[model samples]
Target: MFTKILVALDRSPMGKQVFEQALALAKATGASLMLLHVLSAEEEGSPYAPLLTNFDYYPGVGSQSFEHYQKQWDNFKNEGIQLLQSLSAQANTAGVNAEFTQQLGSPGRLICQLATTWGADLIIMGRRGRSGLKELFLGSVSNYVLHHAPCSVHVISVPSQVTQAEEAPQETASVN
Candidate 1:
C-alpha cells in the first residue's frame, strides 16, 4: 500500500538491480518513484579534493592540481545526474511516474532526509555485503537507513561473490 517509493542509487552495478526492483514495486503498487543519487568523495569515480598539509597550506598542492580535481568532481556530478535521468526515463517508459534528484552529502543521511521530506512510503536500495571490522570502520549506509528511515526500507543484499567480482579489475584481451 505504498504511495511514494524512494530508490537510492550509487554508481555500482548493484544500483541497476536496486532501480529495477524499485520500478517493479512501483508498477505493482501504483506508486510514484523518487530516484536519488547522493554525491560524495567516498563514492567511486568521485575525486577527492587535494589536502592542504602543513608543508604547503595555501589552497592545495598547486592550482593545477585543484583545477584537475575540480574537473573530475564536475564529471562525477554530471555522471550521477545522467544516471538518474536514465533511470527516470526507464521508469516513465514502464508507465511509472518517476522523478530524480542528485545531491551532495552522506548517502544514508540524505536518503533518510529525502524520504522524510518527500513523504515516501518506502525506500528501496541495495547493500554490498559488509561485516565485522569493515562494516564497523566504513559504516553501512543500508544499515543506517534501515534504522533511521521514516518509512519502510527494502534492502537488496548483493552476494559477497558478486561484490568481490565487481571490485576486481577487469582484464583486456591482447589482439595478436
Candidate 2:
C-alpha cells in the first residue's frame, strides 16, 4: 500500500540485501523507490580517516587544515554519489521506478528527515545486527529509526551467520 518507499543503503555488503528487499516491496506494491545514502560527518572527519584511506602521512607532514577536511568530505560525498548511481542503474534495469540521493550528516537523523520530507510510506534499511550492551553503547541506527521514523520501518538485518553468532550465548543459556 506504500506509494513512496525509501531505502537507505551504504557501501557495505548488506546494501545489496537491503536493495533487494526494497525492490521486491516496490515491485509488489507498484510503489516508487527512493534510494538514499548518508555519509556521517564524524566519519569523514574522524582521526582515523587517514588510516582508512591510501594517504600516507610523513612524520613531519603539515597538519590537516579546515580546507583539507572539507575537501575530504567532498570526496566522500562524491564516492557515495557514484555508489548510489550504480545502485540506481540496477534498480532501473529491473523495471523499478527508482531515484537516488546522497546526503552528508548523521545517518539516523538524515534518514528520518528525508523520510518525513519525502512523505515516504515505508523505509527499508539494513542493520549490522548489533545488540545488547554493544547496541546500547554504539547506538543502533535501525533502533533509532524504528522509534523515530514517521512511517513503517522495515529493517533487513545482517546475514543469519552474524545474527546466530550474536545469539549463541543466549541460545546456549536458554537450553540449560
Candidate 3:
C-alpha cells in the first residue's frame, strides 16, 4: 500500500514540476505525503570546484570571484523550515496527511535518508533537478532514490516552457 509517499522538492523548475505532480497523485490516492529539501554541506575545498567539475561553466576566464554574502545562520535554517511549512500548508488544504523535513548534505543522499526516516512506501521526484551537471556526474537525486530508497520511486519528466511554447501554433497571418 502506498500509504506513505515522499515528494522531493527544491528551488528548481524540475523540482516544482515534480512537486505539483506528486501533490496531485497524493490527493487522488489518499496517501500521506512528506516534503523533503536538502541543503548542501560547506565544502572546505574551493567552492568553484563544484562548478568547475560539474557545471558547464567556461573554464578559466569565465570564472569570476563572488562577493561573499554573510547571512544569518539561524535565519538560513529558518528559511528552509518556512518553505516546508508553506509546502505543508498546500498539502493540508488538499486534505492530505503531510509533514516536512530539511537536512544538510548531498541532496541525493539526504532525499534517500529522509525516505527511510519517514517510512515512505513511495517516492516521487523530478528526473533532473537544480544540480543538473553535478547530478549527472554524481547521479541525480531521482536516480539515487530509485536505487537506494526503500520504497517505489516515480520519476516525472516535464517538458521545458520553451518546448511548450514552440509546440504552440503560430499566432497568425491574418487575412483581412
Candidate 4:
C-alpha cells in the first residue's frame, strides 16, 4: 500500500541491494521511487580530509593541500550523482517511476526530512549491522531512521560476511 517509496543509498554494495528491493516493491505496488544519496564526512570511504601528518590547523583555502582535497570532494559528489542517475535509469527501465537527489548533510536527519517532505509511504535502506560499542560510537543511520522516520522504515541488514568480503583486497591472477 505504498504510493511513494524513498530509497536511501550509499556507495557500499549493500546500497545496490537496498535499491533492488525498493525497486521491486515499487513495481509490485505501482509506487514512485525517490532515490536519495546523502553525502557526509562520516560516510565510509569519504575523502573529507587530507592525509596530513602532525597537522595542527585546517588547511587554508589557497593552499595546495586544500585545493587537492576540494577536487577529491568534488569528484566524490559527482560520483554520487552518477550513481543516483544509474539507479534511476534502472528503475525507469523496469517500468517504475523514479527520481533521484543527492544532498550533503547528516544521513539520518536528511533521510527523515526528505521522507516527510516527499510524503513517502515507506523508506527502504541498508544497515551495516553495527552493534554495541561500534554502533554507539559510529551511530547507525538505519537505527535512527527507524525510530524517527515519519513513515514505515524497512531496513535491510547487510551481512557481516558480505561486508568483509567487499573490504578484502582482490588478488590478481597471474597468467602462466
Ranked by lDDT, top first: 4, 1, 2, 3
Quality of model 2 by C-alpha lDDT: 0.81
User: For each candidate, what TM-score against the reference?
Assistant: 0.87, 0.76, 0.67, 0.85
lDDT of all predictions? 0.89, 0.81, 0.69, 0.90
lDDT of 3 at 1: 59
Ranking by TM-score: 1, 4, 2, 3
Worst 10 residues of 3 by lDDT: 43-52
**Who is ahead in TM-score, 3 or 4?**
4
Residue-wise lDDT of candidate 4 within 31-150, one digit each (tens)? 999999999987777898744443435454346766687788899999999999999999999999999999988999999999999999999999987767878999989989999999
Deviation from native of the Cα of residue 127 in model 4, angstroms? 0.2
Q: Give lDDT tens digits, candidate 1, residues 42-146.
A: 676778663723324664467777677778888888999999999899999999999999998899999999999999999999998877787899899999999
Which residue ranges in model 4 land beyond 4 Å of their true spot? 50-62, 163-176
Per-candidate clashes come to 0, 0, 0, 0
Candidate 2 lDDT, tens digit per residue, 1-176? Answer: 89999999887778889998899888888898999998863332332244434334544334465457667667777878898888888878888889989876688999999999999999999888777897887788888899999999999877778788767775433554
Better of 2 and 4 by TM-score: 4
Higher-ranked by TM-score: 1 or 4:
1
